[model samples]
Target: MKNLLVTQYQDFVRWLTRRLGSSDLAQDALQETFLRLEQGSSIGPVHNPKAYLLRIALNMASNRRAADNRRLATSEVDKLLDLPDDAPDPARAVEAKSEISALKRALAELPARRREIFLASWIENLPHPEIARRYQISIRTVQIELKLALEYCDSRLNRRNKLRG
Candidate 1:
């Protein structure tokens, strides 16, 4: 969404109008483009938001054209357009929330070193060797800590699940 802030929205829509050859289609494409961008907030930062948006928009347009082509050629492909995205049921949503809460509590309970190593390894995407080098520990030590952290979380979640049941 931050990357989208760099572009003047009206300008992108105008460009899309020229490219896609229909104002209505351009509007639809622009809305879909931003929806896609909103879905991926982890896109951090980009050097050129305009270029990124253009690429995504172009890809979206291309995909739509391809889908239309498929619909024209095959009856089965046309049915795909009518299918709706299924939302999770309330019970499933509640179960997922409880599981996530248990995981968060388990993560909080981890010892500082193991937690740090665990986060760096799993969340931050730092490699075991990189974490070892950064923390001035052997790679094997990083591996052990991460393993213990995962095991602790698993046991805690399993206990929580039994209680819930």
Candidate 2:
């Protein structure tokens, strides 16, 4: 299984990049696809491994886009984008930059496996069953890992905020 994943990984990524129109986003989808196999989800006798992988990647990528649209609707900036172009607020921009930096630091602090799991689950917006199958763990494990990851990063960000205030 691992051998199959290693051999065809790059090709799958390229296919995804073309489909999604972004190499960076494609790489993330690839990681999430690999994560599913890593967990042993049992797709049940895939005759064409590459095609199967592509299908999974394609599905994941589509799901991510849909999820992003859903999230965007609820986000703070969603209501503001329709407004006429105007000078951006310097304070808001600086705060956004600071928040991004803090997130990077918190991500770097995570254990390697935990970070991968977190990325595949949260950043990539993959389902728990998918993550569990890839990591060869339980859905509960994915949830637990995601919960811990969110908590750790939130704490870091909160601490940084406290310092700033």
Candidate 3:
């Protein structure tokens, strides 16, 4: 049973890693998946071990990505806090800062779930079926979210560009 699980999961991890576009993250997610399996954690079943593992991996990756984004946002805020109140050319700096703020605001305005689907599909390059499975939704839903996200991003960018012009 152990050997079979190892072989099956290892192959699935390899495939998932490729799908996820990050070998290091894949390794981490794969290990977590197996740990959950070994502990008898109720994450579906072993009938389609590959699909189950992929789902686990996708969830883990999404979580890690969110944590990373939070850290980055925190750091950016800290940097802004450290800026000198009496800096030279404050107006120019303020304008530049406003642009960054606008972009961040635009991203934050997107629906959380749609943002996740967008990032996973475009940034992570995960396939629709795999993302759908990971989120326990249909592929059609993934397609719809991705479409909405793209439209949102496009419009936001266009507006920002117009403002700059």
Candidate 2 per-residue lDDT, tens place, 40-129, comes to 866677788777778787887888788887764555576776677676699988998999998999999998878889999757988889
Decoy 3 TM-score against native: 0.40
Go through the candidates in order and give each one's C-alpha lDDT.
0.80, 0.80, 0.75
Consecutive 10-residue window with the lowest summed lDDT within model 1: 156-165
Residue runs of model 3 more than 4 Å from their true location after superposition: 1-5, 42-46, 73-78, 85-165
Instruction: Kindly indicate the candidate among 1 and 3 with the higher TM-score.
Output: 1
Query: Candidate 2 — what's its lDDT?
Result: 0.80
Tens-digit lDDT track of model 1 for 79-149: 77778868888998999999899888998999988999998987899988999998999999998898788
In candidate 3, clashing pairs total 0
C-alpha TM-scores of all predictions: 0.49, 0.44, 0.40
- How do the residues 106-146 of candidate 3 rate in per-residue lDDT, one tens digit apiece? 66889998888887986799999999998999999998887
